[model samples]
Target: MLDVEKSVLYVAFGSLAEITIDQFRELAMGLENSGVHFLWVMRIPFEDEFLNEFEERVKGRGVLVKNQWVDQVEILRHGSVSGLMSHCGWNSVLESICESVPLLGFPITADQYWNARMVEDYYGVGVKVLTDTGSVRGFFSSECIANKVKELMNVECVKGKEIRENVKKLKGRGAAARSAMEEGGSSWDALDMFIDQLIFGKKKK
Candidate 1:
């Protein structure tokens, strides 16, 4: 992990989304094939023999955290973390943007699809991992996962660089948002006004 700068990829699908053991196998194989250092935080508890073997094979380069709660923000903030392979839930998208870490979106269900599009198409801070059938949401192959991981981690490439730059810009905007909530900022002023109204009742007019 220390061999490279901004070389690690962090992967997590939200707890709400359920994935089968087969999908997990593909993700493991793909991350290994990508040859990128990765930390995958999984909510599912897979007590499978194959997972044990897979972990040993990718021992030094990849880490699998199963059925555990990790401090996701802390992981994203690490200097070695370059990208997040995520389900593109709204909170995950915002966290990636705030940390300036580029995203490799793998939206599964519900509003995740919309959020993934916003990350990829609208904000341009991420790239979507498409299925074998070229659909945005569905079962995806290990090859597809490998290709997308490589694409996101390839900083020398045009697309990867563009996404990195975009995420940086988005992170700046997030900073500005924080400032807006500080004292004397617009959000502060609005909240002050609201509190005054609640305490005094409509300003007597």
Candidate 2:
């Protein structure tokens, strides 16, 4: 289903989010209305009546993975995945960064709010889906959800282009950081210094 290049939007809210059925329905309808191809990782069982109808409605345009363990990294790395709708968990944020995929932040709790803010305000690599109110667990209408998805996925838009460029640069930095952690690089040297301090009770001069 994720065969077309840069055409799939990957949606996952992480495992800890406590989303209501109504909210899930809103998300489902929003994705269906967005007209963008998507792969949704649903925590709820597929046997649920609402999901069964949603799957049938979006059969050709979406793939729903329900109540199962999925290799999220593999999905993000796929050529077809262009954008991520995430709960902004630290791990998910880093995975999206390493893959160079831009995010549509839907943060739930803890450090996720900060992560979402950084993604949008600090890094310029993503957008946040704001609620009508200022509450942490505020609800959003299906229309708002659809609009945000369209804004992120519409490559022809200026914001979309900017996000793409920002993510590209970030990906380069991530590659450099990975290289720096290898045997003889700067990160390796720093780690060695810390380990030496721990063992010898003396800081490197």
Candidate 3:
């Protein structure tokens, strides 16, 4: 039931419901072409949404959506899942960052743009299908998706190595951010510092 031998390629398909047909095709084509692979959650997940296809679709396209991760932590820790294709959701980003998988980003919204920026800009660990079209739902041909995935797959020296190193750093950042919320953590330190600044600034007035 749990087999990590064949590399995992987690594709979060439903999240891209709003994307045009061409965009959807490219996404599927990209996953089909990514060279990285994934097994359906059924192979691993005991209770996956795929078992109920009718509820997931939006006008025949899945809406409540393609959540391609684990609820239990051990599933990932146990030599399963290798890579991810995601729409840059907050939890998705956090899970992928923590999972240490090479990711192909497809940001679909505002916060996603920020998440993608962190993955592409700060971490250097993920690749974005960089586009410069004027509109929101930018036109991207299937060929573009295939080519980008090919390029991402071919990244070996600089792109690959740099991304690998940076992903580790991102994990540290994620850890620290999470730690801050815990008691007596760096998060409180920053809050305390901010309060001190406000107190001093007000006193000067």
Winning candidate number (lDDT): 2
TM-score of each: 0.83, 0.83, 0.59
Cα lDDT tens digits, model 3, 133-203, are: 62223565555665555545443646766666676777777676556645677656666777877878642
| Tens digits of per-residue lDDT for model 1, 65-154 | 888888888888889899999999877877778788999998888898888878888999988988888778788889999999999999
| Steric clash pairs (candidate 1) | none
Q: How many backbone clashes does candidate 2 have?
A: 0
| Candidate 2 to truth, TM | 0.83
User: Model 2 over residues 108-156: C-alpha lDDT tens digits?
Assistant: 7788888888898999989987777743357867877898899999999
lDDT of 3: 0.54
Model 1 alpha-carbon miss at residue 95, Å: 0.6
Worst 10 residues of 2 by lDDT: 132-141
Each model's C-alpha lDDT? 0.85, 0.86, 0.54
Question: Distance from true position, residue 9, model 2, in Å?
Answer: 0.2
